[model samples]
Target: MIIRKAIKEDVPSIVSMIADDKLGALRENYQNPLPLRYYEAFKRINEDPNQELVVITNAKEDVIGTLQLSFIQYLTYQGGIRAQIEAVRVHKTYRSKGIGQKLFEWAINRAMERKAHGVQLTTDKKRPEALNFYEKLGFKASHEGMKLHL
Candidate 1:
């Protein structure tokens, strides 16, 4: 398997993976000829130097997993930069096959390479298995994460 920066054409596959689960089904608007908004968001992310949207592909180059890493500069931690990982998903068929672990390993290493002081990610409380998987990768529930939806 190979992990690489996602291109525009990979949007649909990525969205499919994102929408495969119960929670994602409620929030993601994935459909045939997928909504224009996904592509628009991809363009914005792709253009940002601090954002990375990556896809993990199999030997045939089929997209099987994806994640987005955003580097944030902050005044805390001695003006350090932290990498925030989001939207991680592996195709249903690819789960339990070590793909997700590989994805995280790559992202964490990339964050270090980019000089990030730490890497962080938030998994929905509803996803206990996901939380467990993250814990295995050495992440801690260091702080309570809250969100305000507009």
Candidate 2:
């Protein structure tokens, strides 16, 4: 599999991967005349120097996995930059094939190259398998995550 930064044309495929699962089916919309918000967000992420929306394509150049990495600079860690991994999705057919591990490895290497203090990610508590996968990748459950939806 070849991993690379995602382009606008990959949006539909990415959306389909996201909506393939139960959780995503509840929150993602994959319909004709796809929402403008997705495209707009993609454009913004593409334009941001600190954010990367990446896709992993198969031998046929079909997208099979994707994830986002964000570099955040903050004062708390002595003005260190932290790499945040999010929106990870591997097509159901491609799961259990080590694609997710490859994706995380790439992200971690990218963070190291950028001099990030550390790498972090959050998995839904309901996803025990995901949590275990992350732990196997050397991530720790160091803190609680909270959010307020608008």
Candidate 3:
């Protein structure tokens, strides 16, 4: 599989992957005509120098996996820069083929190249399998994550 920066044309496939799971089905809009919000968000991400929207393609060049990485600069950790991985998803047909592992590896390497202090990601607490998958990749459950929906 080839990993590369996602182009605007890949947005629809990425959104479909995001809406493929049960949890995602509940939160993602998968209407017959997808919402414009997705395209708008893609525009913002594409314009951000610190953000990357990536896709994994097979030999046929079909996009089967995706994730977004954001490099953050903060005062803590001695003003270190860190890469945050988010929106990671692989097409259901492509799961269990080590694509996710390869994706994470790519992200980690990219982070190192950017001089990031570390790479971090959060999986839904309900996804025990995902939690285990992350642990195998050397991530630790070092802190509690909280959020407030607007």
Candidate 4:
């Protein structure tokens, strides 16, 4: 398997992975197949040197996993940057195979390379396994995250 930056063509695979049943209510919002704007946002991310999109591909070179890392520069941190991880998803067939860890490890290294104060992310309350995984990765629930349906 190869881990690399995501390209425009990978969007469909990314959308499929995230739309999997395992995603639960989170997918309820972005329920449709990926919209074109996603690639547009990806283009913006690609243009930003401080942001990154990572994907894991199988031997067949099919995009099967993806994650996002966005850098936040803060004044309180005093030159220490922050990285927020988002949209981590692996193909259904590839679940429980350490792909998630590999993706997160890549994000961590990228955050460190960017001199981030820390990396952060939020998973839904329904994703108990993911919460456990993040805890194992040394992340704590520092604040309560909420959302309002529009």
Looking at candidate 2, the ten consecutive residues that score lowest on lDDT are: 29-38
Report, for all candidates in order, the number of backbone clashes.
Answer: 0, 0, 0, 0
Question: Which residue pairs come into collision in candidate 3?
Answer: none
After superposition, the stretches of candidate 1 with alpha carbons farther than 4 Å from their true spots are none
In model 1, the worst 10-residue window by lDDT is 16-25
Ranking by TM-score: 1, 2, 3, 4
Question: Candidate 1, after superposition: displacement of residue 39 in Å?
Answer: 0.5
Alpha carbon deviation, residue 115, candidate 4 (Å): 0.5
Q: How well does candidate 1 score on lDDT at residue 52?
A: 99
lDDT of 2 by residue, 40-115 (tens): 9999999999999999999999999999999999998889999999999999999999999999999999999999
Candidate 3 overall lDDT versus native: 0.93
Q: Candidate 4, residues 1-150: lDDT per residue as tens digits? A: 889988887877776777776554354335355677777877898899877888999999998899989998888777778999998988888899989899999899989988888999989887898899999988999999888969
What is the C-alpha local distance difference test score of each model? 0.96, 0.95, 0.93, 0.84
Q: Itemize residue pairs with steric clashes in candidate 1.
A: none
Per-residue lDDT tens digits of candidate 3, residues 1-150? 899999978888999999988899999997756689988999999999999999999999999999999999999989999999999999889899999999999999999999999999988988899999999999999989988879
The stretch of ten residues in a row with the least summed lDDT in candidate 3 is: 30-39
lDDT score, candidate 2: 0.95
Top lDDT model: 1
User: Model 2: which residue pairs collide?
Assistant: none
